[model samples]
Target: MLREAPAGLPRQAELAATPFFPQERYQCGPAALAMTLGAAGIDVAPEALVPQVYVPEREGSLPPEMLAAGRRNGAFSMTVPPRLDALLAEVAAGNPVLVLQNLSLPWVPLWHYSVVIGYDLDRTELVLRSGTTARTTMALSTFEHTWARSQSWGMVTLAPGRLPRTAQEAPTVAAAVAFEQANGAAAARRVYAAALERWPQDLALLLGLGNSAYAAGNVAAAVDAFRRAVAAHPDSAPALNDLAFALNAMGRRREARAAAQKALSLGGPWQEAVRDTLRSIDAAPRRR
Candidate 1:
């Protein structure tokens, strides 16, 4: 079951060939990072990324820092689910996954980062861009043993406006939030839009888009997003409270009043905010 490629995907898979960069000792983090980010769209050099990702105390690029660097380079460096099938499926779908592994024994743990660029099922080999070599080949079993020690950790970084092929709801939301923080709501708008396509009725995603739109002062867009969110989960207090605020901002006090009332009736954790929304709606001037 371990070597099985995802069904319906091609038996043999290789991503478009990209240039390779060699790493200095303890610089595998930067090398692997450059390979992945370069493919994603940014053309940054590994040396330029070293300051951001490398920590002297850590002796290697930390995974958390690597993710932060991905964000800084305009990608949401997401870790796919830690399973052989999941990793293979991502590669088969054309994503070059940056993986974490222990090159040394687990007890000793020589944490290394490498990019899995392709695989040949017939040969049962996985191709990697590691250290001084591009197209470094290892038996599937060997690769799995090393990778499994690192909890099968792999990044599925996506450039702006692109969504992950193996996305999960919670992680996508976290990435969306981080993307918004790093790139601002305008860039986040694109992320949220792409995410919504996959999870059209996800309340959190809708709220994210709504929040991003509202933060950008795009009240109309915010109203539309929050409305859709409330439609998906009608009694969501947070959604109703936010929708109430957007309507109030648009000077549609009557509608805001109703939404706020429903949220308050739900008596959820947002009740305080719901009461506040109702107060503002009630205080606003009525339309002529």
Candidate 2:
């Protein structure tokens, strides 16, 4: 995650054009969220996002609600590993990163969210779109101290097919699953395919591709993807069971039985699914 600052960017850079939507007190979450979505090319305002993120009992927005709000606006949100290098890379790559900082002491927490838009390597400074201020500057060291108090927690939300600089397979796949559960198979297919392109051997992503394909009635595509997933991880019973199901759908009874048997031998969390697949194959009319 330690990427050198690209020569393409200047010593100091800022997204001065980023719009500032004024926020009421205790609404920094919505305000920072509005700034993030706006920078991502979504024009939602702070007020419109209030009900989506605010929690009356907690007196602040919750992370799960914030993630859901991002998805509702047609993007996927996932946390990045807490590191200065990771943060700078996102800024250099033209993505505004939403960061959690303790404006006060760690023990006496003043949790605040701000967007990191730019940085100056020579001067060791960062520029943020903080609450009530369009452009706020803080020394990199000072910013690190505040950010560290929150364990450098940060997040990025992007439209489908747009990978973040610090993207990882586990979290990205988890985000994809949430998107699939909320939106549907079609949107999730894009996420699975995109992630597959990046991490070809990722077992979860491969399973996601196969599942989405199966749900969409593209059984041939499902078969091909499940085969690839099995090839990628032969020990994955879920992959073998899914391949068996796809084969059964394609009328390849022998291959289907073999796959199901292999899955059953592996003995995983999907044992019942494998057993069910075998029963279904037994019930189906034998191929001539």
Candidate 3:
């Protein structure tokens, strides 16, 4: 696999500056998460994340908890694609990937988390910040064996507006929504804006951006996003409904009523919401 590595990715690369944290028994999850969040410029320590991710009875952190902790610290946390090439691609792009492994047999599982910061295709080895080791090297084949046990589960934590090299539209949008839930509208706005740049006509991205902007008190920006969404998908009732709401918020009741009426006429599942929007526009005081 190394012999025919993907083009543009260096055959050998290491993120020497990535921070390392030694795991305190049953705390590999927090330590690995700290290393990943640190690389993304979060500056949080593993000890600080213990309460957020560590599970005392399970003796380890679950994937969802680990991801949530990253989001709580203002990072865009996402699960990497379940493929070795995808994982290495993120590393080559300078994003350290947090991976779960089962060092023991599947029947007698020993779950652990580690950060992969580099890979040497020439030597067929992957470099990691594992346990108490600042740098640990494992044969590519051996690493795959342990990783496969966990179904190749891996994650990448990144600063807002940054994306994994192998990011896909659906998953990226999903992650942005999750980040919004964990963080706030402002953080999610950045993510949605960044994704919109890549996928200009994506309905979900447009809606997310509009919703985030509206939630952040930027009604004008939300209206603009919804307008674009309506242009891209003229028949989208949700888009029209949102635009109407924003327009009403801005005191453009006349324009809001027009948009809401159109949305109600074309409504599918959003019929009720469109009706509500139209009613709100009607109830709004007229500007004398």
Candidate 4:
């Protein structure tokens, strides 16, 4: 039987009212985001970025064969084309969306992630979530290609009624937020799907789903999810660290180290776990 997604952690709508990072460069993970939701008394299931395995936090090492298998799975197997259609449909309905895109290799250069927070129906432009990039509007035609290279993506809708209580009011958006706060992985996934039906480019939803997959023991699924999250929003520390951990868990020390270092470079509370994992690797004895 397909493992049903878990539920009952904290809601994501509460956090949407105000993003976790006010600094404007960091992106959060589903687990970390859920923790934040918990801090505010909201519940939502935290997902995983990779399959569940006994990863020694103190060593940050994995069995070599596992790494090979993970790499063999590659990045394309995780792409979902239908999801994009749903996302666009949501946007057409005038809902906000967040999409997380990912690249193949860590050393492959370029900013790895981006956020599709909103759309420009009139200008036919995509309002990106680039922290410091002066250019926010990308022609829809241009974005299509950009999105093509992205590995994973998700969408979040606003719950109009839920938002008014928090100073936000969009039914679709509110429903998305309410679904996140509903407290279960299954419900969260449904909400995520609902939001994506119109806006497939939702960062929070992608990250949340990635985290959920990871927790549910789908390591590769989690990695692909986070990869897309990072691709859509380069500065998302949660995605970065989570990806590093996934790599590490698969025993890809070199890639894991690189991912961990990159995550640290991005800088955010979300990097804390990755940083700790890296430190653990440093203290481990090399296999001669």
Best by lDDT: 3
**Candidate 1 vs candidate 4, TM-score winner:** 1
**Candidate 2, residue 95: CA error in Å?**
1.8
Off by over 4 Å in 4: 1-181, 269-271, 280-288
Q: Model 1 residue 175 lDDT?
A: 88
| Model 1 stretches with alpha carbons more than 4 Å out | 1-3, 282-288
lDDT (tens digit, per residue) of candidate 2 on 1-288: 224555455667676656677668888889888887887777888889999999878777877788888888767777887988878877777778888899899678898888888888887889998888888889988898889988888988776777687787888889888878877776778788988888999998898888899899899999999999999999999999999999999999899999999999998688998999999999999768
TM for every model, in the order presented, reads 0.92, 0.86, 0.96, 0.36
Comparing 1 with 4 on lDDT, the higher-scoring candidate is 1
lDDT values of the candidates? 0.86, 0.84, 0.92, 0.45
Pick by TM-score: which candidate is best?
A: 3
Rank by lDDT, highest first: 3, 1, 2, 4
lDDT over C-alpha atoms for residue 242 of model 3 = 92
Clashing pairs in model 2, backbone N/Cα/C closer than 3 A? none
Query: Which stretch of 10 consecutive residues in model 3 shows the poorest summed lDDT?
Result: 1-10
Give the TM-score (vs. native) of candidate 2.
Answer: 0.86
Q: Taking the tens digit of each residue's C-alpha lDDT, what string does model 1 give over 153-220?
A: 99977777787688798898888888888888866887898989988998888998998899888999
RMSD after Cα superposition, model 3: 1.3
- What would the TM-score be for candidate 4 when compared with the true structure? 0.36
Residue 259 in model 2: lDDT: 94
Question: Model 3, 1-288: lDDT tens per residue?
Answer: 334788787888899999999999989999999999999898998899999999899989999888888899999999999889998999999999999999999889999899999999989999999999999999998999999999999999999999988999899989998998888776699899999999999998899999999998899999999999999999999999999999999999988999998898885899988998888998999888
Q: What lDDT score goes with residue 142 in model 2?
A: 88
Residue pairs with backbone overlap in model 1: none
